[model samples]
Target: MSPVRRGEKLPIYNRIGVLRAERKMTRAELAETVGINVQSVGALERGDNYPSLDLAFRICAVFDLPVEAVFSRTEFGAMSAELYRRPDLRPEPQSDPGGAR
Candidate 1:
C-alpha cells in the first residue's frame, strides 16, 4: 500500500457499532475501555474519523478480535447474512427408504 500524502483522508469502514450492539456495550463503555472520549467512538463508528494503528489495536483488544475483523478498507455486508450463509456445497439430507418409525 502506498503512503497517504498530507491532507489525504481515506474512508475506513468498521463494524464497531455492530460488535458493540452484539456485546451490549455502549459508546461510553468502549471509549472508557480504549482511553478515548465517547464522541470519538461515535466518530469512528460513523466513519468521520480514522483511528491510529495503536487505537485500532486497542479497540480490537476490547472485543478480543483482530483488527481486520473490526476495521476494513472496503464496506462490510450484513452481519446476519455473513453469519448464517448456507453453502451450496452441502448435499441435502437423505431420508430412510424403509417405512420405519
Candidate 2:
C-alpha cells in the first residue's frame, strides 16, 4: 500500500456488511446484485477494495438508499458510498517552509 495522502485513505465503509446483515442478505446476494464476485463482497466488507461507481449505484438500488445516506466522509478519509456523509466545510491552513511547522 502507498503512504496515505492528505485527502486519501483506505476508505472504510459506514455500512455495507452491517446493512446486508441487517437485511439477512448474504455476500453472494450482494455480489450478484452488484454484478461483482462474492469475494469482492468479502473484500469490501473487509475494506480490502473500493467499489466502482456502477457497483456503488447498484448497492444503493438494492438498499433503496440515497447515495449520501450510505456514505459519510471523515476528517481523515471518505466513508463508503453506501454510508457517505457530507464532508467538512471548515478550512485549514496549509503548511510551508518544507512542512517544518
Highest-scoring model, lDDT = 1
lDDT of 2 by residue, 1-101 (tens): 65777776656464687779779999999888888889988887677786777877788899999766554453223335425766878889776869674
In terms of TM-score, the best-performing candidate is: 1
lDDT of 2: 0.73
Backbone clash count for every predicted candidate, in the order shown = 0, 10
All models, RMSD in angstroms: 6.1, 12.4
Using Cα atoms with residue i matched to residue i, what is each candidate's TM-score against the true structure?
Answer: 0.80, 0.60
Local distance difference test scores for all models? 0.94, 0.73
Off by over 4 Å in 1: 1-7, 89-101
Inter-residue clash pairs, candidate 2: 70-82, 70-83, 70-84, 71-82, 71-83, 71-84, 71-85, 72-83, 72-84, 72-85
Model 1 lDDT per residue over 1-101, tens place: 66998888778999999999999999999999999999999999999999999999999999999998999989999978988998888778889899669
Among all windows of 10 consecutive residues in model 1, the one with the lowest summed lDDT is 1-10
Worst 10 residues of 2 by lDDT: 73-82
